[model samples]
Target chain A: MAEAKPIAGTRPLAPKPMSPHLSIYRFQINMILSIMHRVTGITNYFGSLILAIWIASAATSEQAFNTVSSYLATPLGLVILIGFTWSVMHHMLGGIRHFVWDVGWGFSKPAVKFLSWATLFGSLTLTAIIWGYALSHWGIR
Target chain B: MPTTTYRTELKKVRGLGSAIGGPGTDHFWAQRLTAVSNLFVVAFLVYTGLTLAGAPLGEVKAFFGHPFNAIASILVVISTAIHMRLGMQVPVEEYMPHGLKVPFLFLNTFFVIVIAVVGVLSILKLFLGN
Candidate 1:
């Protein structure tokens, strides 16, 4: 390999102590679940806002109510609704995981893994069941 | 280990090396309380929503006009909104840059409060037959 050359007007980088986090720690299931919890939480924030808007519009007038409802009938609206539903399910499971921790159990290594996996699979199963009903009955509406 | 020390065992151990009364303890408990409440509220809201979907404007209003549905809806809005604020505050405090942290915290709180206020007002209107 050829020797490296320094860029013009650039000083050499200094070695310094850094905090340990993502860069240092090995990946774990709980770590991923932790991130998923935060992501789904942010999703729920927006989902709740949309829900609030929907209700507020209903309160305003029938026309406003219809407008919001009709938008929810659209393809894009359907996609958002589905995604939001899944987000809620996922975050709810995350909350349950925290509750279990609070109850003074699920701290053993195996138990932790079991709870994490349950949270992942349970959210997906519940979301599928809900959308299953929606799709079967409404057929894209 | 040191009985010779002036402090008693109780005094030595009191509020030492624990987060019991430190900052964020109340926030932590509040989050847990809301989380538990939200489980019930969200269930009720989802059930009401499934029944109300594609419902006509008058029917939607009437459904909400029912006291049970109306109170449940209001509770959902207030509890979930407060929960959202509390949850989001953690990430803002953790991940936001130092200079922007306070601003982001204020914005997060204000946003939740505004949405919640509007939601409660809407629920009240429907409940009161306004």
Candidate 2:
């Protein structure tokens, strides 16, 4: 065997530590809250789409508009509208949380948990308040 | 190196800066556009709803065929459909697994496109005085 010379220019390689995998941990409150945020966001998106269609239909003519409005004014339709309204407010609050996060606040462990609860309780509370107002404004409709 | 930058002081840094570097521009601009479009839509819708106050079916139909009504309706539909696609896309990216991501994304886009086309055409057919 031929003798090999050691190179002067050599660097040591540190064995990289393997971080624990995400799956190793059980499901968490923050994870569920994040998922809900996305779910509400999607719902609100579709709700807005429906709103667009309603407006377009209304803009077209009185008959077309009435067809859309009367359909929307029904009991089942109102239920869907209420669900959509709640989703909108919920998603809006969640969005503000995200925006706050974007600006670099509410990321400490305790703060994160606090924000999670805030997002949840705040969304639900706003949703309830809006629905309560809605019912009063258009009660028995 | 000592922390000369003020950003280093925060114990937990939010990854918001990346938004500006990558898809941030597209998302921000699109959101602004959609918001403006939707405001007009809301306004028109509320107005039309009020106009329908005690109005008969015949009057309603004629109102749709009205020029301002048709133009505004079409514009709102176009902006809304585009907005819907953009809004839902982020959620799909966030939640769906890698294996199912591509397919679901396609489906999402396809679904929105179909709804938008169908919706706009429906409104047009109703208002264009066939």
Candidate 3:
């Protein structure tokens, strides 16, 4: 037996026409920067969580606090710490970009391009400076 | 400039100007939500910090021993978890494929819930003598 079909059928089962295809539309600059803002924000939040835990643990007792501090003493944990610090810096600068946008500037073609570029460059620069300071204080002789 | 054209282009990308929009699911809105929540969390933390400053372990426990601090700590945990979920949701949506994306979304949700429960419970127990 043949299967049931919808009411709209053409002569001898011709394929229905699709409207049209629109291609050659690549993603824009702002989209990528927007994505980065979200990524770093997530990392930064979890980083804050670790900080909170460390604070609570410290409040509990020196023994409890020492466990976390000792974990922080390791190289991998320090890498995580630095990665989170970078995430915080990156998200902070990304936030300033949006703050300017909120005040109704930097949405234009040229201005947006500059602002997007600046977010990346500024985040990298700030992360570098802070990590440099952190390492000097924490790194060995 | 010609950027007004992009507005129309965006509309055309969707089949219709349907009632079901993204429901403020964009990165910008999520960031704004999280930013505001973070401010509140920080304020609460600061207030709690001051109250706990120079407090001994028993006093610290007693402070959070109350119903209000228990509620506030729960709020801090829950808010931070939600903010993290929203923030990470944007990243996965932007960068992941459908197959990989679904699990990450679930993972994000689960991670948030677990942290909120465990973190809040641990804090409450510290105060409540449980």
Best by DockQ: 1
- What TM-score applies to chain A of candidate 2? 0.74
Instruction: Indicate the DockQ of the complex predicted as candidate 3.
Output: 0.15
lDDT per residue for candidate 2 within A33-133, as digits (tens), equals 77787787678666766665664665466677678777877888878877886675565566667667877998898988888888778867866766565
State residue B124's C-alpha deviation in candidate 1, in Å: 1.2
Candidate 2, residues B3-119, lDDT tens digits: the string is 233232221245455466567778877865775666577457545644653455566557778888867767766776777788777777777887888898898888888777766
The candidate with the higher TM-score, 1 or 3, is 1
In terms of TM-score, the best-performing candidate is: 1
Task: Give the whole-model CA lDDT for all candidates, comma-separated.
Answer: 0.84, 0.67, 0.67
Residue A69 error, candidate 1, Å? 1.2
Please give the distance, in angstroms, between residue A28's alpha carbon in candidate 2 and its true position after superposition: 3.8
Winner by lDDT between candidate 2 and candidate 1: 1
Among residues 3 or more apart in sequence or in different chains, the pairs in candidate 1 whose N, CA or C atoms overlap within 3 Å are none
Quote the true-contact fraction of every model: 0.54, 0.14, 0.11
Clashes of each: 0, 8, 0
lDDT of 1 by residue, B13-130 (tens): 5745335676568788889999999999999977876777677778878898899998998899988998999999989988898889999999999999999999999989988888
Model 1 TM-score is 0.83
Q: Cα RMSD to native, each candidate? A: 9.1, 9.8, 8.8
With candidate 3 superimposed using the best TM-score fit, by how many Å does residue A10's alpha carbon deviate from the native?
Answer: 9.8
Q: Which CAPRI tier for candidate 1?
A: acceptable
Worst 10 residues of 1 chain B by lDDT: B1-10
